[model samples]
Target: HKGQELVMADIPGLIAGAAEGVGIGDRFLGHIERCRVLLHLVDASLPGPVEQWRVVREELAAYGGGLENKPEILALSKVDLVTPQALAAKKRALEKASGQHIYTVSAATKQGVEPVLDKLMEIAGRAQAMKVESDKSWSPI
Candidate 1:
């Protein structure tokens, strides 16, 4: 718990046709263009969580505003509703599908939430450090 602060914004839900100006459209994609990382919260309790993840990824790629290239953390929400076996299965499936670590969290119980936040902060800190380094002009004083 260092003295680092991470800011997160809540954007509108993206639909299947969001890239085509459907269901809130891709207008909000620009809002996160500069963001160093993205937390993609997926409902694990529902069916086809992997498919849902792909749909969002597709929309981001279609929008084409650097969103598709941003680092993303896949978070599986509502794990409490599913059994341990089911949760593990979904997590593995999602991990294989996205090729990224899958964080399981239950907002209702606050389970596995802190680790996600900590990971995000760690990523943001690194990104900030890189930005600072790149922003500096080498001065041989």
Candidate 2:
């Protein structure tokens, strides 16, 4: 990865039923309205991780404001706590569920994190370049 920097805002409250203002998740979601991309950090060790992913997807879809349409990076965190077989299983499940590349990372062991950062940098950089081009194309005349 290049030495590029990206700002990531962790919307710490997103959970099931957030769109209905069921919890503080709704409040924090507004903060991400301007973000170019979303990083969904799902816990890999959770039971039925796919179900959990679906619940968040439902909330985003319900929340509206084009959140559902944004490009997303899906990651399964805390892989160090799970066995290799379990990690592979969870990864496969998430990839099938999201139809996107799934990344596994563990902070404690520093495993598979660099790829995540590199992906983020590439995507966010592309998004920023597009935004700049879009701004230049605006013509009120």
Candidate 3:
């Protein structure tokens, strides 16, 4: 590596019915539970974006560890594969469907990647600050 201070782990994606002992369920998803941030990358060109997102959520919730509340950055990956108009429409539908911050990016081309990374950094920084504040509040004065 580049002498990076932080470690990045790449875990296998949790599939449908993962919580019920489906394919590679227990083997990979437990790692996700320990993560502080979840970068959810959904393929937006799919026929039903909302339903797909919900199914993923359900799988995570069933797996437990309060992942449902963890801060998530939704990115409709593979935008380069779709037309701009189509992407925009899907993004809107996904936003209305998830009620969360959404970003569109094509990982292959590096389009729209910086903004998402910046936002994620900002979110992580805030969470760290809040944790410090919470810990301080609990200390005996």
lDDT (0 to 1) per candidate: 0.88, 0.86, 0.79
The RMSD of every model to the true structure, in order and in angstroms, is 2.5, 1.4, 3.3
For model 2, the superposed segments whose C-alpha errors exceed 4 Å read none
- CA error at residue 135 for candidate 2, angstroms: 0.3
| Residue 116 local lDDT, model 2 | 86
State candidate 3's TM-score: 0.83
Q: How well is each residue in 30-60 modelled by candidate 2, as lDDT tens digits?
A: 8778898888888987777788788888888
TM-score of each: 0.91, 0.93, 0.83
Model 2's alpha-carbon lDDT is: 0.86
Local lDDT at 57 for model 2: 83
Residue pairs in clash, model 3 = none
- Choose the strongest candidate by lDDT: 1
- Looking at model 1, residue 61 earns an lDDT score of 95
> Per-residue lDDT for 10-89 in model 1, tens only?
77778898888887757777787878999999999999999989999999999897788888888999999999999999
Give the Å shift of residue 15 in candidate 2: 2.2
The digit string of per-residue lDDT tens for model 3 on 45-115 reads 67777777888889889988887888888989888889989888888988998988789998889998888
Q: In every candidate, how many clashes are there?
A: 0, 0, 0
lDDT of 2 at 100: 91
Better of 2 and 3 by TM-score: 2
